[model samples]
Target: MTLNSGRGLLAALGLLAMAGSLPTFAIAQQAGQEGTPQAVPVVVAPVEMRPVAGALDVVGKISAIDRVDIQARVEGFLQDVSFEEGGTVAEGDVLFRIEPDEFEAAVTQAQGQLDAAVAQQSLAQVQLDRAQQLLDKKVDSQMTRDQAKAAYDSAVAEVKVSEGALRSAQINLGYTTITAPVAGVVGRAAITKGNVVGPASGPLTTIVSQDPIHALFQISETDFRNLRDRASADPDNVKVTVGFSDGTEYDQTGSIDFIDATVNQSTDTILGRAQFPNADGVLRDGQLVRVKLESGTPEERALVAQGAIIADQGGLYVFVVEDGKAARRTIKIGNTVDTDVVVRDGLAEGDMVIIDGLERVRPGAPVLAQPAPDAASSGQIPAAETEADAAPAAADDKG
Candidate 1:
């Protein structure tokens, strides 16, 4: 071969060799990228068996156990209001006073009439006795004796009439002072001092009992039947919990003490009432609230944190760590109690559900799972194991 041709041949061979190495390098780079999958860090909690309550949610209103409207029974000017406006008062406490001048004068006149009737009765008795003695002696005529007896009887009747009048007048005098009929907190005074108030007056004021308030609600016929069936098994199982408008729950639990016998004709609903102690005065009359009526019977069910749930067009779903990877699961959620949701289906005990770092997770992605602080403390998993399992995955991510 010629020198130039040999040199050209060697260069062509080298070029072919370089072209072969390029594809090998490209394949190696692709393989490396595929081998190291991204590990998503997530906080997880194990599905646990807890006692979940079967409950019905409804809206309700708070009401006072006892309410009364104060009114003046006697016609008089309001002399004074003895109770503080919007303050608590005990039963039989004087709430208002009326002018007693007229009532007192009536009582005095009645007493004077009674005294006169008594004197007349005494005189009649004396006359009757004298007539009887004279008739026994044959001095007085029979007709005169009969007249004296009649007069005595008339006097006795008059005395009885006077006594009745006195009693009525005394009652009227007592009515001048109006007192609280029930122990409760008094509302604004409708009739202030110096205003003429009488039985015809609409109302002087209003009072409502504060403690042991009532929660009134209505339920559909179906719900009523369900409640009846549940209550038949356990009469005292009807428990109620109330939530205020601000989303804070009332501390006290109540019992279902009243249920109407007839369903509402217009709405086909049944009225129900639950009584709760309101010593703290947190509940107010006629305030709208949310009510949760739960059966006391405990039920075993799998539960997960509320934050773990996600939704899509299909329905509610959650991400569970399976084989060290995130797997999407469609769950049938039942009732929610507090911060946990009852899982009716599609979840098993011991499954680790992702509660935190869900934004970074995708289906089938490798995960660096660690038990949430709350879940770890609940004995679901050991804290040391969670930390140990997370360390290698974190190092791999860094590397």
Candidate 2:
């Protein structure tokens, strides 16, 4: 062969030798020729079994169980606002007062009518007794006695009617003073003093109960089913906890009280509600919070680094080194514990999950696996061999 062609062949052979002898080591970083596939170096961590508490997290909202809209029950000019705006008030406390002059006049008029009726009935009773005594003494006819009895009965009926009207007047007068039906924090008065308000004037203010609060959250349909099934077997109490955006957790835990009967077709989720004791008024209405729901006893589960997970159209997956090659393993993941995610399926203990150098990896590609620094200290299984001793030997042979 010509010298030029012979030299070109040796150069190609040396490149091939270097590629073939590339070692699996943490520090090795190399690529093959234009069309040849080469081993990709990556940091791996073994799948571990961890004690998981089976906690599910979701965004929730806080609200009050008893929210009352305060409105005037009687029609009158508002004479006074008795309570401060945005302050706490007790039950039976007077919140507002309407003009009582008209109501008081009505009550007086009713009382006078009742008194007049009672006086007429007293006169009718005297006349009926006189007619009856005269008839017995043969001084009056039976017709005269019958007429007196009818008049007396009519007066008695009138007195009863007047008594009912008086009671009605008293009730109307009582309505002029508005009182709180519940002990709670009151909102700003919608109608200030001197404004005319009545039953049709809408709410004058709103009050929401503060001691016990409620949290509402959504759960996926799939997760809802799993939880229901587990509940049937376990029958244990499910605990609820909440945290705020400011990195503070609620001092009290809540209990699940309700789950919606139907799922939201648009989101494929169902609503779940929990009630908590919020004595300090820490839980307010319409506050967004993080809710964690836990149940059953802790169980050992396969866990992998959360950073290793990847998502595609099919679902979540991770790269694992199997028999010196990178393979794709589809995984069904559950709740997160610390920095790892619980793997429901598709992985087992001792499986080396690729956590670093994933950008250079492909399905079925040969990979040089090395334990991540943290994983090594945590006692992960050591790699079969290292490329620390491979590259130099290949170079010497090429020389």
- The lDDT leader among the candidates is 1
lDDT of each: 0.87, 0.85
Error in Å for residue 243 of model 2:
4.7
Backbone clash count, each prediction separately: 0, 0
What lDDT tens digits, residue by residue, belong to model 1 across residues 143-192? 99999999999999999999999999999899988899898889999878
lDDT of 2 by residue, 1-399 (tens): 999999999999999888776664322433223234566788888899988766788899998888899988889999999999888889899999999999999999999999999999999999999999999999999999999999999999999999999999999999999999998889999999899999999999998888788999999999777776655533246778888876567889898988888999999999999999987889998899988887766899999998899998999999987666778999999876656789999999888899999999998777777778887887775545223422333344334
TM-score of each: 0.67, 0.65
Q: What is the C-alpha RMSD of each candidate to the true structure, in Å?
A: 7.8, 9.1
Local error of candidate 1 at residue 61 (angstroms): 2.2
Candidate 2 lDDT at 139 equals 100
